[model samples]
Target: MTEETRNRALIVRGRYDLTVPERALIERGLLLADSLGKKEYACPILNARFVLMPAGTFMMGSPENEPDRCVDETLHQVTISKPFYMQTTEVTQGQWKKVMGGNPSCFKGDDNLPVEQVSWDDVQDFIERLNRQEGTVKYRLPTEAEWEYACRAGSTTAYCFGDDSGGLGEYAWYGDNSEDVTHPVGQKKPNAWGLYDMHGNVWEWVNDRYEDYSSGSVTDPESSSKGSDRVIRGGGWRYYAWSCRSAVRYNGPPDVRVNVLGFRLLSLSSHREIKSEVVTNEQVTSEKLKITSEKLKKLIRLGEEKGFITYDDLNDMLPSDVVSSDQIDDIIMFFIKKNIDIIDPDERETLIVNKPTTGETSRDRDFIAYNNGTVLDTRTNLMWAGEDNKFGINWADAESYCKNYRGGGYSDWRMPTLDELEELYKSENYENVIQITGWFVWASETRGSDAASFYFYDGSRDWYHQSNDSNGRALPVRSAK
Candidate 1:
């Protein structure tokens, strides 16, 4: 690829925002990935196809302005020092069955479907046997850095395709088009480097143990040598587009297996650069994505901390474009989803005065703590569990767990609704009344098949499906006697 062309391919924008040069470069890169001349190795035994990836540097994580970004996805530069081959698609049931002599996938039929429900330890065993058989060539899980590098495939967008999720249906098997189940591999458009299903299908396991990415530029970075959980990437068929972004990451214990968890292999071989694919001559500094107005982010945080924002606050924070004639509705809806209400300026001082402190002023608080694991709010006559279920769980399981709660030996314990969580957020003793050691807490509110969730740290509210277990916490509450 020409230095100029490689630079063009790294430029990212919304679906309708790309320039002619940008569109042309993206099309050309996909054409190259589809060409038969691209370096590819078809495994003799597993029947999996592998593509040779070029060594290059890329911005490793999401820029803060990207919509629905997580805190751990802090941006940094990473250089892959050596060229290597990654499986063209995730390992399929046929491939695992051929080597392991058994199929452990939850989604059955169509041997072409990426295998799921296999734990990281189970994959290690499969890799051990497969390596022993390959004899000359060996296979292992890619490191977290290697996985992101290969998934991005030179693009600097949320997904390998682009920033706008409207086009995600054509490129990945995610919640919108996945029918809540896994699908056959190689059905979507490949990335610039001839890789498939790098965004969604099943979460793929990486070799590195889970750790917060250390700050600073790195070359061939690897995770910690030891940890309780291993990193998982690419999201899954049940996940939405945001979760399938190239920079998105989640993790699980090595022995835990679920239908959404699976992995692909990295082929170990001597480096042989592919001329059409290599672009290492110059560093490709990606255009960091600038989506939502920066003012909106700050305002959103402010609203979360205060429980409500004022029209005056909006006047101060919203950019000209956000509060403009065309974008006024966008501004309103954005805060609505975030559970931030815009009130009159008159109410702002009242909200401020409501901020409770740990001084002598809070000695006579309405919420009373008990030696038993529960808290009683004398104001609302509601009793809440002192803590949560202590681990992440899916919406369905959380509902069941909350309804059957025996905390403080109470029989009527149940899940709190969005309104209840909002009330709790206003508590002067928030950290004391109901301790939240996790980010998200599940709520009783339901929208069709989806359920509401509250983010404790940022005061954001979201509704996810019953199946997505990531970041879900269960904190049961009931009417106090």
Candidate 2:
């Protein structure tokens, strides 16, 4: 084929080769990936299409000001240093059957629908079989960071489209539109990067262990073996729009498979750049040995002795070596938070005291009461509606109640966001102005037919099904101004 015709067809499929034609495309920088838009590759064995995602940097978590943001989504800079190929849509039942000789998807018949109900361990077996079939270990699940990077497709908004969940209907099959069933892939508009069904299809299993993020910059982070829980991203057909947000994260045991859980393959040829070599006596015995318990203890000791590791600095470190691979989440949290300037009680005290004040001394239990049935929390510079002696309301009605509230001489009162309610959890004990009991209170964050709520008793927050008809009190709040 002519070089011109060859280049045009090359854009459609990329096979691993060192041919003169491929070399010419490489010279033009089109063989490896497209600089703009998508680079498509059709897997010959499974006949599945994969899209090439360009390497770029993005804030990996939600901003503090983002509405309905979770506490674990601490905003941090992340760079995906290398471009990789990600499946355009989720792995389908047909593709799974082709590779593994069987499909485990709950929703069957449509060969194009994403394969679900496959555990992380089951996916590993699928990957192994696929690798053996392809004669290369090029297919694996994307790392948590890689998954988010690709999902965002260069957009930092809640959804790949933008902040407004209303636009999500055009791009996702979520709680409002999915009719509680999986649909064929690529039915909705693809993200800016031309990857389809990223927002809502099925929750895709990633290669990272779920953990709280540190507010610092990171590069090529792969939480491969950090914790026991394998990371899952994207919202399923049964979930709400909020769960499908780019920064939202959920995780489960590697062996646990649900009808809503599936995974897509990530292809990276640069895997050989880093190789695991057996530790020899000479290397391990060296004085400046890199891998050892002593070094880690020394680092921890330095953190205790002096505030040596800044929170930002700790965030930049690769999390793989921060804690033992076998460590449970509860124990690993101590080291992770300690390195990030959080585990220390003194640091916590300092954070609470050193806030921009609204002339509210937290110790005095000061609250500026208003005639319109609202109280100003001067410590947090937020206005809260006086708690009503009622049980609760549905999430929809609770949000409506906040918007219609004319209390505290404010017409703009609305249900507090999850982040805002989380702030009250700590300060509530000090200021008993609100009669908050053990009951959960509704937050503004919604996922499909579920909404996020905070419990004042243990200060825990979780998303509950709105259809369950469970009751949760509403605590409306607005800006102090």
Candidate 3:
């Protein structure tokens, strides 16, 4: 019998009830059986080849000890509940041209090269048109879960092959191998599922909105439909090998289109409805603003777009007469107050993810409502919940509640310090700028069994017993930076 056949036979009849480590070994072997196997489909119109992926349960996300793992990659079990056919490579320039009648890729050499410089929204448009022409809703982007499962190919290691990144050059066109440019797809080795360029080529967009993973096991898990950004997987030609790991994830606004971004296709067995979610885009600059303000607005726009502004950017946009080191420092401080960074630039660097989820905070006449469900003190760059914990709680529970708060997609909230709470009470204006519903707010400063509580009713502060629950409420605060 052929080697492929022998491996397939062994996997088909393999015992799965073995010890956890032994069963993992068997599954890894099973993943190897499908290498170059014949379960694939060819799209005649686009000349795209897709490999059939099997339904199986695998642990999603990275382990705590995994190197370069993001906090968002909460390790959990996930099942790709349905079998689907994934494009063997990212959609190529040729395929995109065949369907879209235009070549949008920055690298224009070969038709076989994976298309780059596309956005999630652009891919959605392509899919919609393709579906209309083919008369089927089967074509779509893979869910985040399915993308990881197929990318892992039953291996639990960091990369599809193993944890060692040294071997990645054989399977991916990464920064180390590609010489800082995208190359022809499928030139690298395929994963055990016969999928090519599933590691580094271009960062491929999946079909879900960006959200943190749930630590609990889930079936065919997908991201929440209510987020400002979409998840992109598989590091790009310009990215490091660790970023190209099976579990590494990053997100960008759906409308973001950069040279390192592209997407692959997945054909479903059953019909699914088209997703046409629209998100509002707030333009930074306005004509109504004065000329000087317009320049600063442009700075804001640049900062929000890429995360940080270059020193060159500031120099170019500033008034020509106001060109001194002290003047520039003052200008930088102004922008910093608005939570924008102006830093020294290395032209060699690429991809600035300024505010990953669309500057979540917006300034009003008085205060900025950080739509991430927090109120902001622009002076301190500290964010707080619009409302405090409605009921009274002991100091310990209050601390826990504040620390555990994940309001508005933020996770660093904690009990405010005594001075911080005092700042919230605008004693001069008789205003509670922080706007907590409760009268008394807990502060982190404590004296043995007593903790400080700020009273907004009269702008007074005092230490209370640690177990005090009478009119005591927890207020969560996090630094916007």
Candidate 4:
């Protein structure tokens, strides 16, 4: 084949190789064409934690007339370039421990408490350790500009909430709510975009060199090219609520460690260009089937006669015929059915035997249960029990929890809607299971209106019930494959 034709084939298949014919170009051993075409690449794994900040221009500082406005807090017009992710809250003791091997917070109650008394140098050490642990060198302290940009979250107000300090209790634990000490991070309200403790938790160390703002808009600004002290921002627990303004600034030596000091880390992400090829079944030839239809039919017949197909027989017969290029889907479906018989039958039979006797058995055995522990006619993989359970969560919260759940060999669990829940009820004795005390509270798919719930005690469908009053418990749970 011609070198050009071979190159074209390789390019179409998205494969990179060093082998190429010499006939296409090497005249007198001098290279003529660029044979190494660029191939698309992708990140097989990407994990970077970030908080989404909204986009807007805000007054960069507090007014001069405002109480406790430091000279640095000069009112100015600062236009945030765009929306971006910031740290969700100040770095917590738990997170610090993960990197530093010790907790430094004065008020160490929960691991979620904001880490304090850590110097800028100590924070850098923690960042280095984190980078090493994660096997990447992208992690570092956020530059001072990046810190202010994220803390502000596109808001120009003194606090992301507003100018009024009276409402500080809702968003932050300052001098009043702090009780002269730092509280756990994220206990108070979040900013507009759900970030917590961006204002008053502790002073956060940033990576910028301390310097005054320069004129004009800066894109991806960094700290001074050189400086002795690093920039610090955000107010501490002992400070007044207004001191926590988004535009506020402070600086400290890298070695200075105090009760109010802490730091957050940032990591630069590498972007990759991915080229994905869509291969249709039609494109695959019959010879590449891996398993032929005739073979599958023979196997199925043998299974029916002998009650099972031996692995030896399956291995001896090349699968190439059992799966045809055109019949790929059918072969896959057949194998799926066989696998289900091997894996799901026993569990299904157990569920069927345990099912309350009053319910009529449907011939279709493919149904699975939803979050309420009630059987759903459709396939789902969630398990649930009622209130006496630990983790109290509403439907939305429960749904979020279930989606993240990695249990029972299944990851596609979800909260069922009211209709889906009702379908599981034993219609004949709905009240029995629906109102069953201490068993399970049915999760309703309904929203904006009162949520519907069922009790497992009597197995009945009920509506307009208050989740708080029913004594029906919501069991935060996941699904089983």
Give per-residue lDDT, candidate 4, residue 384.
Answer: 32
User: lDDT tens digits, residues 1-481, model 3?
Assistant: 1344324323422111112222222223211122223367676557788877877899999999999888988999997766778899999987775444345678878988888888888899778645533433468999999999999999999999999999999999889988888998899899999999899989999998888888788998777668789999999999899999999989999898788999999986421111112212333233322454456566667776766777678668764433334234334433443445555677315435433333344555445664334677776777777666555577886887676555554557788998987876763331334456566888999999899999887889998999876678887889988
Question: Would you estimate the TM-scores of all the predictions?
Answer: 0.50, 0.50, 0.49, 0.45
Tell me the TM-score of model 1: 0.50
Q: Which is the leading candidate under lDDT? A: 1
Q: Write the per-residue lDDT of candidate 2 for residues 1-481, one digit (tens) a residue.
A: 1244324333322212122322233223222222223356676667777777777789988988888888888888998776778888899887775544345678887889899988998899778656533434478999988988988988878889899999998999889999999998999999887888889879999987888776679899876456799889998898988998998888899999788988889886331121122212232233333333344455456555654344433434323332322122212233332332333344656644553233222333656654234577777899886563143366665665566544423457678888888887777553456655327888888888889988777778899886433457666688977
| Candidate-wise lDDT, in order | 0.71, 0.66, 0.71, 0.51
Minimum summed lDDT over a 10-residue window in model 4 is located at 14-23
Question: Which run of 10 residues does model 3 get worst, by summed lDDT?
Answer: 270-279
Which pairs clash inside model 3? Answer: 306-354, 307-354
What is the C-alpha lDDT profile of model 4 across 369-413, one tens digit per residue?
322123333344434322222223344434443443322223354
* lDDT agreement of model 2 with the native: 0.66
Ten-residue region with minimum lDDT total, candidate 2: 271-280
* Colliding pairs, model 1: none
List model 1 lDDT by residue over 1-481, tens digit each.
1333223322311101212222232223212222223467776657788988777899999999999999999899999976778999999987775554346678887989999888999998778645433422257999999999999998999989899999988889999999999999989999998888898899999998888887899999988677789999998899888999999989899999999988999985331223334433332222211223345567777887977787778777655433223134334433443345566778777767674332111223777775344677787888887677554577766776666554444558788989888788777566765767667888888889988999877678988887776567778899987
